[model samples]
Target: MSANSKVVDINKNREELITFTEEEVETIKRTVASDANTDELKMFLHVAKSYGLDPFNKEIFFWKVKGKPTIMTSRDGYLKIADRHPQYDGLVSDVVRKNDSFKRKSDGIEHEYGTERGDIVGAYALVYRKDRSYPVYVFAPFEEYRADTKVWYKYPSAMILKVAESMALKRSFSVSGLVSREEMDVQQLEEDKESPTKRFKKQKEKEDYIDVKDNAQDDSLSQREKEIKRIVGKSPKLKNDLLNYLEHAKKENDIGEEEKMSINKLDDQQFTQLKSILQTFKRLA
Candidate 1:
């Protein structure tokens, strides 16, 4: 992705490093204010620009996770580099529904896993370079996360193919030291981004807090979600009010296209706040 702003040109060759978003600019300034590593931040910015990546994308740079500043290319980063590379040829990548071709681990036997669609088992990719004699091949298998088919629910085929393609590209161009940090699982990266602070914790409290301390000991997230839905379903007026409340609570930029449950996604503190608003609407109804 192209940068949103221009960066300070630090080259004798007169090349601008890259531009940063307002948030990144803040991070850089904040790092300096807090006596943190600003030099390392600049170094990462340069590396990101060299790769033609936008640090503001959170793939290339984010201050929330680690202390040191360095470039971390996202999945987008890998795709972008592949798109711009002069030596690049077409990529051959696809989802593998079964182990039809490859040998199996259990019995050391190769049999048809069959035509019935099941969980996507693996991904295969080959990066062909015009200059290289041999194409780089990569076969990446999917791993289960917390017993949930996490990333599979989002971009199972596409993401898996990307992983394989990136793996092949990075390995093939080992001499160039090319890297895409997205080779790190995108699902894991998302979960890591939310750490130490839940992304939905930003809901504004428009009403007094409701006391849900009694059910606070319940460990089941499903239980809380069900209870909240039940309460909201009691009246149409309540439901409308709940939706409107959430809509009003978020600023224009704060809302994602499908971020309707910003309130529902909130933590206990905000949940209680939302419950109070629901109760008010119920009383009025």
Candidate 2:
């Protein structure tokens, strides 16, 4: 059978699988894989199709690093692939804490934690296979994989657990080459332009796209600065209020490094939402 036939045969049961038509291929190139060349696009499509991943649904997508395309998926995507494996029996995972009870033995793993689990130290995942006597256990430490992003800042324990689960799934299913976005750094995620939250927000539109702008500190105003200035046009009092309020929030630890880094490039809606949130914090102060 031809490569196309093989791809079709692999995912024949999945009625929602993407059909790579001439126009559809053009759309994929223009949207998600814009930076890719003909060969890169072909390779991306082949891998995505082979794994029954639909890029439109955000199961798998391309990441451009230094003008080169790299395939990346989410933790859920890893689970999807693992579930498809004939021997994949089940998965078990949890976050470990500094004060929590955790142990690893030759045959099994043990962990216990309470609601007040001090701080997330690490996470563990166990992938059960039908053919294996013991499940595959992988422990991922927080310090090793944590990124200084808003998501990690807000959900450290959950994020670390995802990293562990992704690692375990990859190893258990023999999945290779592609990396999960949860394992990537802030710079890599930023380079992707479209974040998971932004994708969801724009999912309804036919030509949906996130307006990603540079957050670099230049002498001139950045896009975010410009937007803020426009919002505060001719309102010197409001400008001072914002600056003073932000300074106070920083001093109170209401805002951290992650928020500061992201504040540089937030779209208008996000900026407005931040202002509303800061107003709430101001009341508590």
Candidate 3:
């Protein structure tokens, strides 16, 4: 049968699956508010299994690719959670400071004292990209801490509840553009003239394609032509005989026997002597 006909039959055998319901989406939002462990995030798994939709998957992918949310942590970490709501930010900040290591850095001329170490607290921030999605905004004590050894701390559930109350009280503070350093660098490059690295990469890729195309053209040969070329020193009659034998072996599904015989013939002492002579001819050619 034709390739297209086989594809249609295969497609017909496959089944479609439904993802999550509206109620399930609401349940997910509620579950995210608590300190849910990796296993506790079963709702997300179910959604992924059903429809292959994952909200946190993109965040994780971005984190893996860009190496943590640096910019978000830098900006959000300084925001006084207590000022927005009575003692809310202070409570979370206090917990983070106590649990983790913090350092002070000079804001150029002025020394701004901020928590530089401890468990980081993350909240859903407004998506910075044109795509309207929520990205997690991490608030930590400091941005200079080593990612490998530094222990990150999270705010207490009670503090999160307080912040949620303040969020409900005043809906003025909207989550805005919070992008990673890598993402910002890419954006800056797009705004400027073509970057040198990008131009070099494009030129290298074009050259590679040209080389591949030329090599492919040089390698292109029909099966019969290949057989004739491989058996160059042999008589035309012998080459034709070998080709015919190969065709018959393929048709009868007896290729293994022919392959063994072909290997044995090539390995013969006489064949090796002939090959040495052919190599001398190749050097002269």
Model 2 over residues 127-148: C-alpha lDDT tens digits? Answer: 9999999999999888777765
> What's each prediction's clash count?
0, 0, 12
**C-alpha lDDT values of all predictions:** 0.50, 0.63, 0.29
Model 2 sits at a Cα RMSD from the real structure of 14.1
* Candidate 1 structure quality by residue, lDDT tens digits, 39-111: 7555655556566665434335422122333244544556667767778886766666753555433212233
Evaluate residue 222 in candidate 2 and report its C-alpha lDDT on the 0 to 100 scale. Answer: 66
Q: What is the Cα-based lDDT of residue 153 in candidate 3?
A: 23
- lDDT at position 227, candidate 2: 57
Ranking by lDDT: 2, 1, 3
What value does the lDDT take at residue 160 in candidate 1?
Answer: 70
RMSD of each: 13.4, 14.1, 25.3
Task: Return the candidate ranking by TM-score, descending.
Answer: 2, 1, 3
Alpha-carbon deviation at 243 in model 1, angstroms: 27
For candidate 1, which ten residues in a row score worst on lDDT? 203-212
Which tens-of-lDDT digit does each residue in 192-233 have in candidate 3?
A: 356779856854543432211211232675443343356443
Q: Model 3: how far is 216 from its true place, Å?
A: 16
